[model samples]
Target: MTMRRHRRLAATLTALVALTAAAGCSSKAKSGDDAGGQGADGVKTGRGVDAKAIQLGVLTDMTGVYATLGKSVTQAQQLYVKQLNAAGGVCGRTVELTIRDHGYDPQKALAGYTELEPKVLGFPQFIGSPFVAAVKQRVDGQDKGLVLPQAWSASLLGSPHIRVIGSTYDIETINAVDFLLKEKGLRKGDKLGHVYFEGDYGENALKGSRYAAEQAGLTVVEQKIKPTDNDMSAQVAALKQAGVKAVVVSAGPRQAASLVGVAAAVKLTVPVIGNNSAFAPQLLATQAGPALERMYYVATPSLPIGADTPVAKKLVADYRAAYPEDALDNGVVAGWSAAQVFGEALKKACADKDLTREGVGKALLTLNAHDAGFGMTHDFSDPQAPSSRQSAIIQPDKSVPGGARVAREPQVSDAAKAFTPGG
Candidate 1:
């Protein structure tokens, strides 16, 4: 699914320490010896920060599951770094990214983290939730570095080190179900079939489906698949056989496309709602395009890249100018917003005259109701709670700049509000 939609490590200590004198090395939050000297701005500096630049990590998928999203996310943040650097950066230190493409392999993801962990102050984008959950222990106990993942699994909540940017998977799914109910697409007696991945992302979403089903007096038809499984024929067959009125997908764009396309082929023409990572705008050009006409998905952490909002419009224009050849998607917003939040934390850290890894984490906790004119206010004060419970109900539209537009503005459903994080 959008792996953090978000997670995942690096190298030997001795070899790492050897790079300390050179530009390649970095360290965890620790004593002054491990962290380097202060910058010209007189702010205390540590790992990933030198008098000249601040290094951040980008661990993402470029050739697997979320390849399209990964590219946009990395590029958007890269654009942020460019703009920020042009503006003189935080505390006179430039922003640089140490990027690693994990290919969506868990082992490679961890290795990428390890290799880049010491070289960067923190990770602004880590693309898989399960990968993040896998290295949760290292992040909490050993690294203690800040990670702003693209993922929103409830299981990832409550961690001081890893902060999820939007409503969790369960919460978002509940909101998705609510959308179907409100639209009269589903009813009390209807069965909501949930086709989800087999890992943290899908299971977390499964929690929401069951909860919403119980609340609405509906039944949940379950179909579990893996990230590698693109064919939804069997799954759709089962869903149609079970007489499901609506469907919720908590997987990547591939799975969403397959489900919707396959569903249409089998004449199981029910409403299909997906999590944020479930749709990529590029799919609009494929054979599945017509089938996706009725597809609906949820977006959070930020609104779509092209909305009525001023910031959204500006971003769409800017991104087009920057990457004219690429297609627009929600990933650009996700990428930019994550970096925006991370930059705010850095500013706070600079203001406090402490730009260490630890300083950034502390600064981030103080950010609440942060408004970047993204049509939503994110409150990062609670680690266990999502920054925002609301998500925008979106539909695919080729006429739009990002290939989709908002159907309903961002809002939190009563059911989503009442949701508690657990499976």
Candidate 2:
């Protein structure tokens, strides 16, 4: 997700994030004064790392709006761990995750972080922009642990610890608006309707729409909604009355579906685009399927699931075999990609002979233009910036394995590249 990052499973799906806590590590890693020792490999260890294994945290939404999406994300992360451990682990140590199912609750998310903070080295998959931001001070000031969140709000950027793996929501939204413009979803002087959440995720995206509208010579019609609100009938009515040409959805899958479905029933047909988490494969089986297929589009950093690329093929096969019941989705790719980056940093830290939290953070900065053979590549050298400012436009297609196909390749729009997240 530039999603699977914020609001209730929104952007939960601008979306890819999740995983569960394993029962325990072979043995819990030492923390505080008890942490940091020499491993058999002569690697220096610290909190979350011991002679046997290293621990990370996964604070995710499992029972909330993005439950299904979260499950897929978590499973893929688990799958990555399985593969990594089987391949001799990292620097003579196995990797473990302290996963918490926050169910998209703010208090729960905060509590989960509080509980896991001391026990883990860092968090590879914290899913909410607001939730991640909630603990930003501790992470940056005190904990100094590395974090790769599923959310993409610009507010989380400019921190050394909380590194956004993809473009932030504001930048992703700018790229999305660029997609609409290039595809003729909207032209000059057209009014582009934006339906978004009132929280960090949606508000950040709204910023981008405003900027893009100004850059592209268009008017923006705004509609604010909460994550719990599912009926988009009223919002659709308002956008229709405004005579908007295209619409941008910066919420979750449910909101997108409702808005698209409601708009269709009212014959307010128009091209609708969303941040990454706004669309999911499961929605294709619902009443919104036809409408989503006809008009709904999503912008994300990675290629859609079941893409023709080698990485996608292998992942789909392995995932389907591992969990035959779970359908393929882009969440898998997002989860795997994030986990892989974490692994890369861990490997660099291990090679540096310092698997401490700070060591891992430093290792990440050394990885510029890191490519995992997916559709996107990132430069983590600058903490103040997102790794990349690019998004691929995808359209829902029931026939595809993930129920979606790429409408555009991953690229940073001139508007997006020039735009500043906090500017």
Candidate 3:
């Protein structure tokens, strides 16, 4: 009786101990799963966001024709994220930024997007219009992430998931025409020349120029150029022969310099205006620097970084402190402003603790008349409308921080308001 009873008791005790340990493991697993399922604000999250941080991507051109601008963009984005993290990031979660260079190539941009699609919540800056167009469908359809593209084309106005921070190229060109006609005293039937790249950004600006020319009773002489073209001498010579009273350019810095420099050489003393992307601070260091200074006006969505505003001052100080070796440029301001817009949207998305891609998209659509202290306001309330039609005219001045000074305050021309997208 002693041996049999002792053996049965020992076996029962061992079985009970095993059952207790299994129950404890099951309970711990349940707790861990619950925490992982919820965000910091106790709401369910989507891709690129977790309880501790939200990850975003930046698609830019670091080794292309726009490399200087791209580098500034990357730097400003980093600075903005750093400041945001220091001030307690969105929804109590640290913000992580992943930057990928696309070299201003559509294929490279697509590849970068493919790689970043699964890792980031959204893209704060997609640098090129052509690149954005190449990946728009994938980004808007399957990826389901919000994208704020650096390209401001009217053609992009209808996308549900894309947010534009400033005026479209079309509207900016209309303003340029207005400034040239009214302020610069160009008469009716005068020939206005336009030299542009053969892509969305350039085409959109060209459309605006054409519309404005018609309205002002002026003739338009157009020359379509490619991104790779470095010599615009022939184009300038043709415009000069056509007796153009003014010229509007929609190209990058290299082409801009070439066009203006050649125009000056050929004794084409007409006023030259450019879209925002056409001017970079580095242009002043080229032989075209004198030509740019002779008569060049640039249409911009924001005041120059040299503007005497509190926000501009803060941006300059922070940018210089962060990159003392780099000169402050409009691209840095643009990048910083884009990040600010994204941060605001993130804050809105966190208001209800819904930090998913859908939440961020809705927040972006609700942003109405957001003033970044850049002397212009952006309204995202109407999805069918372009972000902002207002723009300021700037003339090149080497003394300025960004190599430009405000020539005209922010204004929305009647022609810009009446212009149609994709027309």
Compared with the true structure, what per-residue lDDT tens digits does model 3 show for residues 26-109?
444431112224654586577788988999999999999789889998899999999999999988889999999989755566
Per-model clash counts, in order, read: 20, 21, 0
| lDDT (C-alpha, whole model) for all candidates | 0.84, 0.85, 0.83
lDDT of 2 by residue, 113-213 (tens): 76787788888888887778767765776568888988888999889989998888999999999988988558989999999988788999999999999
Candidate 2 stretches with Cα past 4 Å from truth are 1-34
- How do the candidates rank by TM-score, highest first? 2, 1, 3
- Over the full model, what C-alpha lDDT does candidate 2 score relative to the true structure? 0.85
Descending-lDDT candidate ranking? 2, 1, 3
Pairs of residues at least 3 apart in sequence or in different chains that clash in candidate 3: none
Query: lDDT value for candidate 1?
Result: 0.84
Stretches off by above 4 angstroms in model 1 are: 1-33
